[model samples]
Target chain A: MRFPRWLLSDRTGLVLLAVLMIIGIGVPALNLLVPPDHPLHLTAYTVTLLGKYLCYALLAVSIDLVWGYMGILSLGHAAFFTLGGYCFGMYMMRQIGTRGVYGDPVLPDFMVFLNWKDLPWYWHSFDMFWFAALMVMVVPGLLAFIFGWFAFRSRVSGVYLSIITQALTYALMLAFFRNEMGFGGNNGLTDFKDILGYSIHADETRIVLFVLSALALAGGYLACRWLVSTRMGRVLVAIRDSEDRTRFLGYRVEQVKTLVFTFSAMLAGVAGALYVPQVGIINPGEFAPLNSIEAVIWVAVGGRGTLVGAVVGAVLVNYSKSWLTAALPEVWLFALGGLFVAVTLLLPYGLIGLLRRRRETAS
Target chain B: MSELIFEPEAAGMHTPVAPVDATHGILLYLEGVTVSFDGFKAIDNLSLYIGDGELRCIIGPNGAGKTTMMDIITGKTKPDAGRVFFGQTIDLLKLDEPAIARIGIGRKFQKPTVIEPLTVLENLELAMSGAKRLRGLMTTRMSGEERDRISAVLDQVGLNEQAQRLAGVLAHGQKQWLEIGMLLMQEPRLLLVDEPVAGMTPAEMERTAELLKSLAGNHSVVVVEHDMGFVRSIADQVTVLHQGRVLAEGRLDELQVDPLVIEVYLGGEDAHH
Candidate 1:
């Protein structure tokens, strides 16, 4: 009656998790130890890069839930992430109202400089961090739910789903690019003063944000892990593999897909909310379909079906991006495109997949 | 022979039937069922009745609507016109596939659709209970009772030795058994199986027939099969379909001699295949 646990155990899962914890805690701590004027500010750069990677990791995790589990490849998740960041950015902008060159408390400098009378209605709740955070999660989740409900119920799948999702983000990008949209126009939201009364310029605050990003990445990973390990997770994989079969197995496939899609989008929103303060800007460019593709590239590079692979993919891709841009800035786009093509054609399981395949073959 | 009578309600049996329907022993009634795909009639005015605890075999040519009939019954394809009743009460036509499944009707595809990425135990666990949310499903682990039920099913399917093996790694025959095991976990009143012995070896097919025959006294099974030998080994009643309609309905011996059944099987050219 007893079953051997080794056959059922996710072997790569443990090693992947251990590596994440080390990176999550180790990088930020290392940064804090490095003095301000040290010529080797390697740790500081690493912290910033890793924090950005965590944000990307969150985005990739969200994408994986829908793409790997529910069979939804939303090529527009970056739009939600950007929207969430913009919402947070508005709050940061308001906090910097009087500190700007024009010093208008009632209006942001861009608005005062443009001779606008008052702050818009959406901007009213920028003063409350809680409200901004609420917007950060809810806005994306609601959009995803509504969109998924309509799209999935109508029986959209495969390449058609990808195109529609891309069009959705494209529409948002176009809308946000316009100045009348009140989202600081094409320049977007920046020049943040402080979040929760701490100076943005302070290294302590930056490190805290870095730590928080790590926590988010870890929490996001665990949440995804728990989700995929559940009966629902089996249902998701079933839906991903054979949706019609899963539906016949007594599952509301569309509802299951919609729920997971919305949950994933909310995670992306949280990542973007964290990303804005640390990275310190939000723009229509973030909504670009290319950015969403980059997120997919990260997931594909790490391992699409594996959550830890997603985190690793994000960090590795971004780290390489920083290095490439610093070393050979002009050719970075070619390298990025080549990476995607290579991953798609060659490294299907990405780094994690290769490790898993190697282990399976060796055993 | 007198001491070994095969009565359904034998006193020594431990099987449980939900309720014995005295009125025709009808477990499923498909009345005027019609399904069309782009003006092609897949299933046209097909009406058939399956008795409780009966092992019914549906034999048809490739395009004779056997799969479509099963699809309509299992809620995979909605018929253009029909009344499908589960045990003369549940209106199957009004329900979706999942809803139909929850109401004690289970189906097995010809392809042996077991969740491959999951372990054999995990696949069965998913089939048994109906929680589809991660937070709740994760919070509650399978109880000892559930575990015993799973073990019992595994034993029945002859996969007890490979309980922890990944379903993806199982042989084609074992995968079919695992899928059958999955259906058993749900405790369904009726099982709709399509081509159970399609790709199976002779030994495997014989084992499958035995496994299905053992289910007949407690669970009603309607098998859509092309393998006549497999059908002959397990079927209590045989329903022959031709060109989107039932051509003959009777015991296997009687149907084998029917001219219409012969005509359809041999493509209306030769009266025998």
Candidate 2:
């Protein structure tokens, strides 16, 4: 098969794919094949954590597509993430049929607690796995399309666009926190029993989810890579550097922005779907503006405008987050802030940019 | 040079063409155009007509409504009262910026606004007239014919050797040429060039004058220039704008000699020359 020359030439992208391949195979082998006493035996917990990180990587890649290439700094990507989670979480909720404390086959535990008789109208088709899976992308994609249609048409951009995106996610968080919203209120969606007839607690299931997350990350990265390599990709960069220039070139700037923004939202939604399954829950807290901001930081630290950098930034920052939050919980927030400040002041191009500069100088 | 013909229908593509009826020899008609910002009239009762394939130079001092006139033509600024038409049929006032551009009106800003991160060739490709729709942009690959056209433009703009280089690394003069090259990729019938020779070496200015001159017979070039020497080199007719109205319209020499034009604009400047 003939690969695109641009994709083949991308050294960083190739290296990232190779690393993902190794981990995808090696992590599962270490967890499943190796004895529990072995030093390299990767525990189920570690696999789940890795799975979560992969989800975050996918989310970062999605953000990078719009923020890095298209110059849309979305501060509400977490809203799409949470929506995807909720879509799939609803499916997981349905899988609990009579297995819950309330023993209701149709209504989820939260709905039972809320004294609701029937499932909400929007929650109807989510009972089916395929439908729920579809909604994972569709829900976020639709919301982004509508929001972007208006925002981009009106020419809202820069800090104003970022501010409105933040508002969007915050508003979603507030709405989801309501019991009447049918999304489990503040607690969100949880108490899953099985997915596609497989027990959610099983080690094999966790391994599968982990592997799927890796595949999704790889797929998302490749899809985005392909997108940015196209003529449309050049148009995106054109829009980023100069909107008016692109407009005068006869490009419908609003349509381009809307389409890319919606696609990015769908990618974020997929990442969220994978995240919910691994973390064992999906909640309104996922829509917190801070979550969205943290995701942006991941892109910035890795390197804005570089697809591989997004994955690298997401994994590295999130790994540090896991370590710092566990080891020095109080300093985590301060550390994140300081790191962003430091990156801005010193490493304006982020880690990938630093690496590139070093390579150029050495050459 | 033989491939310069832009046939939208021949390629089985739908590139929007403004049904420009230039039979009466008027390509653009701006009549009674008036615009204001905060009740300050920037353009007051300004009426202008551009002939088909005419090289018209619009010269004026700061706030003389030169830029505002270009703005009105390109749909960037809506005139409070005017009939802006392309040819005798298509009303320019009804179209938006992109729509106007699609209909063969290309505007070059005062500053050279090239997509810096993109390569010189890629910048030109983005500015190519067709394949602008969402689906087309996503899937369209550069055909041999398109590549040939780009090469031709690269040669025309004198940036052939730097086709693969990022536009950001280009020199100031080269950036101006690249912007013109981008406009050329659109195959526009009318080109609104703003300050084509701003901040340029004398040599670059001469080359620009040649490029603008060469573009006239095929494309109607409206050059809004500050440098009088540059305008005199290329302009067939000069339109002097002052205080949102046309002060005079004639050759550069005639305008230079006209008392009203001299008192308002050329009186102080011609002393140095």
Candidate 3:
């Protein structure tokens, strides 16, 4: 396939690969090879923190694939991310196997506490890491396909689609928070012991997960780049610019939309799965509508349509979020709001666009 | 000067048809097409016919349902009651917009709706005749001959000079030409062009008239135009629409001098104007 060559030929794509490579190698070295007492030593907390950031970057790239390229503003993307997290959380719960606080081979602590005699049928096969991994991608991908089928076929678009997506995630949030839903309710599946019998607390495992997150980000970027450069990509942009015109041109606009929407959801699921292992928790809080809104800001701050810009935006905004929440605490959301307003007014294309402008002027 | 009449045999040499409509010799047949928006009948019991490889012009005042008629034929608007057939075999009313378009029916919007961000060449590439299925586009690349075809269309439209420019930045006349060029890419059996010269300079209008006239013998062209001079220049037969029905259908000279058409459209006081 010409897909690899197609991506490497672009300057933005090459720069993305180089940056990911640096982060992938440098972070692991700093965390493992360097002495722990050294001032520049990367701590285990920092590794997990950056791992989580990489996962967030992957999520942002997925959003940019649809929103920037196809003009689909999905406000409920966090639902897919959380569902993927929950899928893997189920696996982690199954892996606990008699080591839980309840010490039941067949049930996790939540099931035991709920007085269930046997593992719920839905929870079966999660004990195998491979099946759980498959579900991580499959579950979210299926939901997005079904949602897009109903929405696009009904000709629902623009702000109405966004509103419906928000309602969907909100509904899922309520459903998952109930004690009877069989998920952990308020405190979701957490305290995961080991994955594939590898210690979750090990620094080596953290490094591997961090590097894997970085790889996923790079892979996601390449895939999106390849997709947009193809004729299929041109059709997608045509749909975004003039949907009726596209339809009249003989392209099935709804099918095009559903395919991309489903693909993007799968990418988010993979990101979420990686996230659970690093954060050591999966909870209903991840389904919060505010989280999805915050993701849009990341794409906006970085650049909406450009895949690389989405990654840049996610890292920069989240870093600011972490720093502000530590220092001023209550000022983060306002800062995010202010940043969005400033980006909209001044740099409508985000930081990547800003760089391109500077380069154009300089040249 | 001697009068010249186009012999029917000369017209079919460059004809493009998926399957020749030899039996009917009629490219499009519509009967009793009625559509209403919010209880205001935009198209009321409309019936029309277009012959194979014929260049027909439809002229009407604003709100006379010229566009609505085109919409019904192209399946953009589903008539409450109507029968629409293409080439005597295809049931047009049963198909959707894209399906109708795919089966060799192309319609140009009143406003130029090119993908603004894409280059003029890219716009033509998207409109070019080929596999429109997602799988086909994903697996295929444009062949060398396809590039040559795009170049030919650009030259024909006099847009060769601006082929590299963004469609968004094209001037009003240029955008209109580009849209026409786009429609030509599909090689549709029946081309529905709405207000082709609405915003054109006179020079552009002349070129557009020439372009439409040249396309007639190979492709059946239906022009919904307000410019009488353009219609008179290219129209083999002119159909006058008034209040969602055909007011008159004949040669331009016949319709221009009709007493009833004059009373409704061309005024008695402004007869010579």
Candidate 4:
């Protein structure tokens, strides 16, 4: 009845994480060390791409917290991420002021050109970085809490909950796309100068953002681990496996699922907040339903239940995406779809599942 | 061993250890408890009174409302109309399931519902973790004393040897024992078990009966079961239900001689009666 020590232990995951960290940080430093005129400078592009992948990794981990452990397959997580991005995007736009192309100190160039007179009421506090950061976590967390409170309390679950979540994201996407909404219409927000007084375009700033992304990923994973490690964690798993039994065991299954779902959405919001500044833009495109579905695929590809599998899957899939888009642009979507199908059909447990099986057999 | 067995308190601190001599009258009074699903009344104004430390068995045909009655008592289903009292003090109707469970009423469904992915030990540890919303339960792991209590209950349910096993891999009967062990860990004064012997082998059935019988002196148990033989072996009193109402109530031998009880069992032309 004794399982292998490594099967249950997080040591293997921790080791794999350490190796990935070394590569993520070391590769960027290695590229910078090369002579500026050398051909090796081309590899620096990988740093931005990898940084983006790390942000996606954080998003995947967030999705896994709800879907894998709590049995809430939210198709609206992109809404939270996009909402966070928009919050940060507002702050970034405010930093432009007179530096924008139109040279209008009070209004953004897009607004000045569009002939809007005053800022919208909701755009009041983007001047403060702290408020923007708070909104990034709180907005999504609040939305998820309200939605989940209604859905879960009404006993909505399984495929029904999934469909409703999809509808929610679609609705937000439509709302954000409107020209009158004052969120820069379809062009969205861009043209940032500084974040907390640091020149965002500088190499040192990129390194700082990259390190911040890594730290966020690590912190998110630990927070999730701490949650699932407790008695409440056991209750969530029990709920996922058999909700009726959990209820009979005197658990408020609805409350547990709602709390976890809100927490998960908040994490995804943080991911989106960090993503906007590093990439230098936030658009209506961030609200795409496909993006949320893609997050699900990342969790599925890595191994849904394993926390580290999420990070691995996100990085691996995006890396392949970047490579494919560069090498064969038209075929990238097909390849992505094919990877999803192949993983679903042949390996339901995904890549980490295969690794665990092989280790078990070898042992 | 004999001394420990004589001292019921030695069973565990959580175990119900009442004095031998007392009035020991009805502790739970379920009067006019009625529940309806859609239009049909699942429990039809059913009334039953259970005494303290009484090993009462409820026997019925399918759809006789045995599960519904247990549901009403445990706060799983609300009764549209009824009064359910615990020890002349607490009204069970006003409490939610978790609240009712905290007040020393534990329930076991027909299926063995242990936390299968967890170890048998963790399953018992979780039973002692208290209500789910209670935040501090997780920060504190089970103390050594709590562990000893869990082991004591496991020994009682004959699962001590497999304490570290994944509950998923256990034999069918062992899973049932593990669930019972979970209830025992909670140390509830009253246990409501549904179909404890169904799908069990004869040996397992015998052991389960023995376990329930041994629990009778300290704990009051209400078992809703279909198997008459199992009921005869362990039940101190048996209540027969036909449709949603009680058909007969007495010792098993007395119920066997009652013509109404016989008619309910064989499904006669006089079934409505």
lDDT of each: 0.81, 0.90, 0.87, 0.80
Best candidate, DockQ-wise? 2
Give the true-structure RMSD of model 3.
7.4
Whole-model alpha-carbon lDDT for candidate 2:
0.90
Q: Which ranges in model 2 have alpha carbons more than 4 Å from their true place?
A: B1-14, B268-273
Which TM-score does chain B of candidate 1 obtain? 0.87
Of the two candidates 1 and 3, the one with more favorable lDDT, higher being better, is 3
Tens digit per residue, CA lDDT, model 2, A170-236: 9999999998888889888887888999988899999999999999999999999989988989989
lDDT of 3 by residue, A211-307 (tens): 9999999998888888888887888899889999888887767777887899899999999999999999998989999999999989999997889
lDDT score at residue A80, model 3, on the 0-100 scale: 93
Return the interface RMSD of model 1.
13.2
Q: How does chain B score by TM in each prediction?
A: 0.87, 0.92, 0.88, 0.87
lDDT of 4 by residue, A214-303 (tens): 878888987787677677677777787778766656566676677778888899989998898889888888888898898889888998
For each of the candidates, the C-alpha root-mean-square deviation to the true structure, in angstroms, is 7.8, 4.2, 7.4, 7.0
Each candidate structure's TM-score, on Cα atoms with residue i matched to residue i, is: 0.91, 0.96, 0.95, 0.90
Candidate 4 lDDT over B28-76, as tens digits, reads: 8899888889999888988998888899999888889988888888887
Q: Write the per-residue lDDT of candidate 1 for residues B1-273, one digit (tens) a residue.
A: 112212312211112223424266888999999999999999999999988889999888888898889888887789999898888567888877777776678889899888888889988887774443333344336778888999999999999999999999999999999999888887888999999998899999999999999988688999988877888898878988888998888888888777767767834543222
Which has the better DockQ: candidate 1, or candidate 4? Answer: 1
Instruction: Tell me the spans in candidate 4 whose CA falls farther than 4 Å from its real position.
Output: A1-8, A37-44, A328-334, B1-24, B129-134, B137-140, B266-273
Q: Predicted candidate 4: what Cα RMSD to the true structure?
A: 7.0
- What local lDDT does model 2 show for residue A286? 91
Per lDDT, what order, best first?
2, 3, 1, 4
